[model samples]
Target: MAHDVQLEAITYETKEEVPQELKEKKLSWQKLRRYDSLDLESRSIPGHHHGHHSKALTRSLIFRLAFQSIGVVYGDVGTSPLYVFASTFPNGIGNNDDILGVLSLIFYTITLITVIKYVLIVLKANDNGEGGTFALYSLLCRYAKVGFIPNQQAEDRDVSNYELELPSGRAWMASWLKSALEKSMFAKQILLFATMLGTSMLIGDGVLTPCISVLSAVGGIQVATTKVTQDMVVWISVVILILLFLIQRFGTDKVGYSFAPIICVWFALIGGIGLYNFIQYDPAVAKALNPKYIIDYFKRNKKGAWVSLGGVVLAITGTEALFADLGHFTVPSVQISMCFVTYPALILAYAGQASFLRMNNDLVKETFYKSIPKPIYWPTFVIAVLASIIASQAIISGTFSIIQQSLSLGCFPRVKVIHTSTKYEGQVYVPEANYLLMVACVAVTLGFRTTTNIGNAYGIAVVFVMTLTSCFLVLIMIMIWKTHIILVLVYILIIGSVELLYLSSVLYKFDQGGYLPVAFATVLMIVMYTWNSVFRRKYHYELEHKISPEKLKEVVGGISLHRIPGLAMFYSELVQGIPPIFKHYVANVPALHSVLVFVSIKSLPISKVPVSERFLFRHVEPKDLNVFRCVVRYGYTDVQNEQEPFEKLLIENLKVFIRDGFGLPQSVLSNGENGEEIMDVRQVEEDMQPAEIEREIEAVDKAWHAGIVHLIGETEVVAGKGSSIGKKILIDYAYTFLRRNLRESDDVLTIPHKRMLKVGMTYEL
Candidate 1:
């Protein structure tokens, strides 16, 4: 529908300009209230508006993407085979009558949930080149454009000079920008915070998948090779764990090419093996495909059936990762990959495992190795092991991506994020994320003491994630697709009910120790959520609401404000006792140092500008001395890193701050000559409640020293704060990129010049 509408710049007569933000207050049902999926800024990548691209192939991107891709995004879900079969069979599908029941349940679960719900439905919801919660939340905030009140929202108290530049590429950019200037900053920020919580929870799941899969696989190996002690299997799992961690500092871009084809072959072998077995016992389990099997299994062995659902739920373990990693592959590409490669391979393997169970006619704790010949078994085992390794890679990659994304959206504390190569968008690395995963994975390998135990603990967190995702899906189908309430309700009820049944099984296993993971996830969620709240600082804009645009334009239009000859104006840097720089303006050279105004501009953290007017003229604080101080408050938020906008804002509201240099009340700017020192500003409030004048004075002092923004180590104020070294990791390495671009001499250290600036902050989280 928007394609037909040309992208013409809208012009309004000051009368009709209404100075209004273009937003829709449509009562379209319950007001969809723009979610992460619907935001305009997040709707496309940097080059994507006209074309497309990831911002840069930097080390941070490599670490982030790789970890997420391997850890949470793809790995966990891929390695679910360890217990998928064992737990699903024997009582659930082990017997003749029940074989069909278990098989049918597994078959349908994959087809509907993994294939349809994941590959088709959930993955399609990705916003632009990014996916996951924070990315989605950003998109929603950008597009919703609900509350806007001029400059009132952008004036944050901590760092009062940040302004976000909204790209004018989408259908509602202008409207959203206007609304953002007024209100709804908190709502959008809240969503971002929630999204971060989601990412952290997602990553915690990563440490468990490989531990469970490899552990389960190893258990089977031990069953066959009794000569090989369980310790040997444990050692093997540990070694693989070690290798996975070591390679993380680098990325799989070069090695990843080997990933696809190898994984493909692995799946093919699985599919072929499954097909062979299915045909042999095809008749025995044919009845399993029917709905009656589910009913029968539930009726005859209710408790067992419930227990088995835990294993059944394992089939779709990585469902959420499918959506989280949507940024890695385009919608069509991921869909194709899942349908043509991932899905078939998984389904056939499950079927093949079922056949093996039928033929064995017993509780085969060693399905993966025992179902086949010894010579074939070893090689097949190798293939499956290789597959498990690949699955691990995927989980690692996914975890990296989610955490990196969390940092980008300020959901986590700033960490050392490095993109792997300038050429590959997929290659990313995060020192903090990598080290943490490595530590957690190692802990996972050792803590549970066995993969079998890990398996019991693995499915719970994923179930929680899956349930939340399902809720989002229901919202999309109903809110965006506008499906009938009844239909949406029915779909949610059905999916949720079935999911709960499976979750119950896992929950039952909690005492068997599944609660360990759930507990871990809960803690992670808390950290992520808390940090976002505490460390979230908004960049403040020094808006000049006192000055009228009309008055400022008059001067640029040749009208005169005073007898002052030159434009020598000092903004509210509020230096104590007039620095030598300003003295230069008054002393020796002694030119007409007139037209000085210490303008104080207040800005809101998020855009919450009022839609009705451009600026509030009422509380317009005016000053009386030769230094006329006028203050304009803005509500715009989410903008970071830019030159101070004091001069520009002053021009916009000249009449409000300007005063005839006569006897009058003294006005003090937040950062003015008269401003006094107070306490250090840790971080700005996420809500942008204007900080006290005392904090502003301190900010000016820090600004005078030209302090570097601490991306890392300042986690006391950020969500999911990483190591102080996290920021150091990026800053230290960033110099390498810049050094590579500059002349390198043995006598000098090389790096991103930004890092060279001396500061008190610690490096390398």
Candidate 2:
């Protein structure tokens, strides 16, 4: 029966295993369809248009997004003015001339790092409109086979927007670089580890940003009057952090809408106040914008200036959030918001503080609040606190987005992800991550208890993330943009030197407080590495243990089992062959379902898969077996919780397949050898009687109604007898601990407890 099955039954053998006889055969149906067993590429990319510039966007919409982006993308960077000056001169200003030099560093750092590196360059490296370290890694994976996961197949490359656009010979350097990255296992591991380390550090930024931003804002109470003690401010900031994270379940859409106006008002007030101070105090202080001051100030201060860079880098702390949050906005909007609004406001804010310091150098610690006119001090203080909260909110949401992406890529443990907006696919809320971040933020605030200490930790996280972004962006420019090698070298010479300088300064302060993010990142990297390593091993085990059609028939024949009435949906991660767990289930169970469907839920690297192209169907061999394989592909941002609609669509596609006679070739149906004749599937459909098609559809409908049971494999991992101690510690201990503690596959899928059947098994990796 298996041998007699039609050519439409897609075989599950690798390319090397397929015989020349099978390769020569083709059907009329294969000619009509865009996809076939031999060719899997799509005619068009799904739900995404690729270009450096966004398509079909209006100027007004860009401006509107620009306005909204201020609340989300710029909040963290914008709030830097509240603490940068204070942190820079922690021991108070030495010479009035030092103010000019510090201001020069602030100006050049924001322009070089934020405006040029990010807004102009790194933003263009986005993968199908999604941005981040993972997006960059995904982009690299598309161009080259450097991804750590071994589960990717040829069909994965067929996903829309996943195709590689070959560069011309002009980019020979890039071509050489790509070849090197693909061939070197050691290099691939380093790239993967660095990307993970960057992501872990970003998560650390999420915890520290809120701690310092809120504390600095509330510290204005001490400046306003002596009534508010430092401890009181710490407790007050803790309360605000608790309240800020509590509202995260409302998601970015609501939070952005509510916070946008407050942030706008805050930016306006600071800009206005800065201009006033610049005019009233010392207009001559504008000379600080000269590059020479940066040189002279360093010469004058020596080691003190280098250490002050630990504080100077704070001016650009939120730069990562700008690129990380690009998925939520257009490049034009982020660029306009930064270049026109956020950039100017920060400059004037720092300038006004510098001008005031020129006259009253004694108030360096109190520069921001002291520079404000007494009449509006109280009102400005209120807005400062609100802006700080908004800044905290933005980074927290960005953290959730990154973790959700990691979970989809199998780099993190399973967690509950709630889609917060119906219109925007990127808006998501992770309940578990949110609470954990909140707790970490509170603990840090209580432990450090001052803005200066937290500022040390904050600068380390920020600079380290920036350094990693530069490294990733360099590769992207070479391999993706195919930029000239000379220009890439120049970029490294300039940006690389500045970031390394700051990196050294922060490392100098490791004992003061900089150890926090390092500790956080190390722990997170271990968790991620453990989960991803175990997942890849398990997938390989299934791939190696796959059962052939002959073996499957033997098992069924030996069971002598009754064909029960409903449909059994066996879920696994394997895309091609039947998993070993299915054989284990059949051997132990007394009965089998009449219709069996093997369902594989796969996550593609793209942002969203179109509904029309979501399901790929393949009939298993043996016409009487009634076994089918359905590979449901989803983009990383696509919602997968709609169970009823998913079931309806699956059943409907199966009915269509049956009605068309599985698109059978004429030779197979008529017992001719080697597909000597061909018949189109449309002709077969036309020949079928309406009643016969209806009866076939009715049988499937009845089976579906009889009750669908979801079969999920619950596998445990242990080291093989031949394995060493390291394998045992990694698999038996770390993997097992994470598997038992984290959310299970059934829970993440929202499978009902009554309908889910767990088949337990163990694997010796």
Using TM-score as the measure, the top candidate is 2
lDDT of 2 by residue, 290-384 (tens): 89999999999999999999999999988988888888888898999989999998888888888888899888777788889999999999999
Runs in model 1 lying further than 4 Å from the true structure: 1-78, 89-94, 143-197, 537-765
lDDT tens digits by residue: candidate 1, 501-525 = 7777889888876877777767666
Give candidate 2's whole-model lDDT.
Answer: 0.79
| Top-lDDT candidate index | 2
lDDT of 2 at 612: 61
Error of 1 at 393 (Å): 1.1
Error of 2 at 711 (Å): 1.0
